[model samples]
Target: MYKGYFGLKESPFSIAPNPRFLFMSERHKEALAHLSYGLGETGGFALLTGEVGTGKTTISRRLMEQLPENTQAAFILNPTLSSQELLATICDELKIRYRKTGATLKTLTDKIYEKLNKNHQAKLNTLLIIDEAQHLAPEVLEQLRLLTNLETDTKKLLQVILIGQPELKQLLQRRDLRQLAQRITARYHLLPLTKGEVGHYIQHRLSVAQCDRMLFERAAVAEIHRISQGIPRIINLLCERSLTNAYCSNNALVTKKIVLLSAQEALGDEYQATFWWQHKAVKALAASAVFAVIVSSSYFLGQLYGENISEKSALNITAPAVNQVVSDTSSPAIIVADNEKIPDENAAKAITDNTAKVFKIESDGDKKRAVEQRIVKTDKPASIPMPVENSAEQLSNLADSKLAEDKATSKVKEKLSVKAVDGVSDDLLALFQSAIDDTEQDPQFKNSANQVVTPEVNAPALSDMPAWVQSDLPSLSFEQHIYTSEGESWVKVNGRDRYQGDTISEELVLNYIYAQKVILTFKGQQFSLPALSSW
Candidate 1:
């Protein structure tokens, strides 16, 4: 709208990347130099990427224009094609003829190869330039790579240049695409223009459009840079809108105010609402929200941490039994009591809650033993006299039983005291004498000195059996079981006692006294014989 008013031949700020209106900022020159050098060195591939409208496409076109007269270039404007479609498109771009009815990817590729060979024979280089190359699929890009492989030892048949947004660089970096990426040989990321370049950039375009004087104020150029962030496409859009607004008002030069208003209408909706974050109220609101999230997270985390504690608190026993267990000083009760001080307040609160279930102890005995077994194992003082008790009537019954026991003991002593008789074995005499002498001799055991005791072994060992055994087994003329320094039990026989002096039998030995039998060994093996009958 303002081109005529500003003495311009046409719209200078059109977003289309026209060659006549091209402005090569310093970075653009470096990028072009890098990519051109790459294509010159190897006929493989070159990569040029940039933000939207940073002039990647325009610069690539410039590269094509700069190619030698012997070079034939194929430009692909839209790369969003399948492998077969892309191969056909490449053939079309190179003017390589193929049967359109049966053009498979292989057929199209073969035609391209023939063209490349023909170009090589004629001393012409083939270059394929794909704009917006980021949209090319992995398989399609792979197909392009295969075309580059049709080469002689000196150079690739196809010198490919890939131009796209920054995402093209990312796409090439894929694990599947690294082979193609490595062949690129050279790559450059075109950045947006600097704030200072925006002024010169505007004047260069104005000059191309036949404008002799500066049509935009200095402040307006700065505003343009701010609104567009130096992106070429957005800069052109804002400058165009600003020019229209200025023309509507019949203003001579586009001002900063015009650029600002134009940008408000152009980019307002897509822009994020972040300015409010600087306000005190909004900052406070965000802080509160963060605090709430943290608190909620901690609460759930605490519950997860307390799962073990809750499991330990669950007891298998009934409530009354659990209360009884708590009275004991074992580790489980103490650990449950100490859970109140856990660092996680919520966890601790749950564990120490009054209504929480009580848990059984972790001790192996606790898991396996019956209640009675556990009670008997304890060192506690109090216990029920459930099985046995002391009383006057009970004492009388015990006294009668005691009297019968004494008469029986007396009869055993008398019988055991018999002298050797004809036909009676001499071995019986020593064993009988040992039994007679083992009767209690101490005043403490005198009232019931008739308890029968076994003499341990041959002669001397009989006195070394046990000290308590000596109290009931009084010292007699014959060998007897008696206390001694050695730990082994010993017994005497009339035949062996006279010769073998108090030596214990280290091997299995037995002595049968009528129906009462005794087994003894030096290894401390003892046998409890059943009660002898009164007969």
Candidate 2:
């Protein structure tokens, strides 16, 4: 269709086995020489094989043209016939008459042998060529071998040449076919074109078609080499498609871009990545896809685990030195827990509300000075009531017993450890309880043993937690959760450790568990964080 527009006498890239357009390369010449040696002088059998679309038939055609004028050739395109059918086909090819009905294998073979003898007597070389010889049954090939066995003192009466794909060589390797394999005098296997020859091949075809100009760019030629892998048939296909593309666009020549688009159109998506994977855009696209998946997956998992806090859901309360519950104000407050305490409340962590009074105590000449400051970060207000008399001394005493407080922290954590793991750490609890004994006796403290609770955990959100979560969250005591990788629920909380099902004291009001490092408030004043001095 594009021949007229491209100044070509015919389509340059037609895949037809037209001998007129054959461009014999060194490989083809070598294969031709091998077939000539086997079949030219005195042939019993000559074998030629190649990969599909590698031009095995083209070489065979050239071989036929080079044969002597006295040669009588019978060519069979399909070799799938049975022994009797094969003999019948040979008789038909040489115009030998046979019985129309009830023809036996012996009857057909005798007729073919008579024809060969007559041709031999007349000084005519009888040649038999079979295409797709790989599909020939063993018995059929054996029958042909037997026919060629009828020889004169000098040469065989019948000369045979087999043209097929690579499987023909493998078929000859069978032990059952050893006699036929040994009788074959010459074999040639044709491979694909090389990169340099590919360019020459294209130019040869175009020149044969009478196109005088350079049709494919140098880069386009390189791309065709890479895509077609030097296979003549595939090269013809890609080139034809590329030319059609150029014709459609009314371009005088083919470019790398046009060839690429043609490859995509002809080969589809399977070949798209094959070429572009070496380019930077493909790598960048792959990297961007991975990053997007990681970010999206993290967010999705967080929605399932509720481990990290987003700004929309909770305030930014920095990781703190210690977890102190403020109960003096009506509003409840929680301060982020840390391994150690920092004297600077601003850098350490934020207090819940503006009215939450934080008293800072530092070593004085001989006494401790208590400096009062209001630090607020959330709408909820959590205040700690202080005794007006010797307030700094009371806090000083609390500060003095650091080892004791750590012990108490550990003790409370054990009693509250997810009991669902089905065990408790008694020794650690005893040690921690002993540590907090002195601070628990301070008169300013109003917390009863039953009033303490931790925030909600292991759920998508605090507001969505079960009713039991509020009561079961860790209390004034320290809390440690043992997470397992097995079973339906991995979190082991106190109690039967059923998810969100822990039991707390009746005196304590169970509220939604809030894990905000900063202050968080529910419907009313129910949460509070006591300053370290107050604790």
Global local distance difference test of model 1: 0.65
List residue ranges in candidate 1 displaced over 4 A: 271-535
* lDDT of the candidates, in the order given: 0.65, 0.67
lDDT of 2 by residue, 136-240 (tens): 998888888899889988899888999987668768889989999999998887767777889999999999999888899999998898777678988898999
Q: Tens digits of per-residue lDDT for model 1 on 1-535?
A: 6777777789999988787677888898899898788787454998887777888888887887888899898899989899988888888888887888977877887788899999999999888889998899999999889998988878887898888876676577799988988888888877777778999999999899888888889999977875676788888888888888999999999998888788887677753322546543475467556756887888699676556334534533221112234354442332222123322212112232332323332347536431210111122323322112234666799899979877766765565455669987886566555544643442212212233333321123334556544344322222223221111222233212211122233333333222132333333433222222110
Lowest lDDT 10-mer window, candidate 1? 370-379
> How do the predictions measure up, each by TM-score?
0.51, 0.53
RMSD after Cα superposition, model 1: 42.8
